[model samples]
Target: MRQTLLATSLLGLSAIMPAYAADYVIDTEKAHAFIDFRIQHLGYSWMSGRFNDFSGTFSYDAEKPEASKVDVDIDVTSVDTNFAERDKHLRERFLETDKFPKASFKSTSFKQQDDGSLMVTGDFTLHGVTHELSFPVQKVGEGADPWGGYRAGFVGETEFTISDYGINVDMLGPSSQVVYLTLSIEGIKQ
Candidate 1:
């Protein structure tokens, strides 16, 4: 009788334990994650730039998406717009890498759409200011990598006013306030 009572108590305890979610670490070495942005230049064409270094980690399960989370860190000094001179000016005048050398995003919630898409809402910090941002994310691909690590990829795009991040729109001289951003991330399972 004592053995049965102990077994029942153990099972009951296990059932009441809070469930934990599986997590994956960002493959900083081979993530191939890209953070690219574009802004209108001088009221004419757009100037595009990409950051070369960043890292992130996330937990996701298609069946249990509510438990998912994401955190990403980007290096501001790695911004590359192809033109060396402009890139320098961007880091110094606009981004001010010396003052704020890093930018980051951390997910707060996830809402699944009827169309099988996800709306991940999070806090995005840039230029030393934090703001709420949401992006529509879609599963791009998923499978095993050539290196034997399992992987999953996703794409998210959003546009926001650069001025909202405390950037000067006039110093750049009549540039558009809205900036287009896209993220392509491939995370490896840990």
Candidate 2:
């Protein structure tokens, strides 16, 4: 009878071990978070640029959406347009990165659509302001790397008016209110 009780205890322990050890943390060294933002330059075209430094982490269970979570922080001062003067003005005056410093996102929930895409709802904090933002995320795919880490690709796109966030490109005079933003992220699971 004692032997049987010991066997049952061992079985329970083994079952719980897998559950307890199921967390997967993103490998930041191999991850990429990039953003492309464009503002209207004039009545004719737009001025485009991207952020150079941003970092984040994600927790995901390959099987379920409820088990997935994401947290991302972006350095606003890292704004780069490949031109020094424009970058400085944008950071110091327009964005005022000294005061705001960073932007962040934390996902609240995800829903898998019938087309194999995802509807991700989250809170985005920018320039000391917080807003509920939702966007469509598509799983570009997943694959194995030669180094043994797994690679997953996702593409997300969203647009917001700069004025909505208290950004005034109106100083540019003829620019529009909408600023388009696109995010392309590559995450490596370690």
**True-structure RMSD, every candidate:** 3.1, 3.5
How much RMSD separates candidate 2 from the native structure?
A: 3.5
What are the lDDT scores of the predictions, listed in order?
Answer: 0.86, 0.74
Please write out the lDDT profile of model 2 over residues 32-76, one tens digit for every residue: 557778877665777889877787766555567555667778889
Residue 11 of model 2, lDDT score: 96
TM-score of 2: 0.81
Model 1 global lDDT (CA atoms, 0 to 1): 0.86
**Minimal lDDT window, size 10, model 1:** 168-177
Q: Judged by TM-score, which candidate is best?
A: 1
Q: What is the model-wide C-alpha lDDT for candidate 2?
A: 0.74
Any residue pairs clashing in model 2, and if so which?
none
Residues 1-190, candidate 1: write the lDDT tens digits: 9999999999999988867755777666864788899988878788899989999898888767777899999999999999999999989988889999999999999889888878999999999989999988998877788888888888899988878899874654555778899988878887
Stretches of model 2 off by over 4 angstroms after superposition: 1-31, 173-175
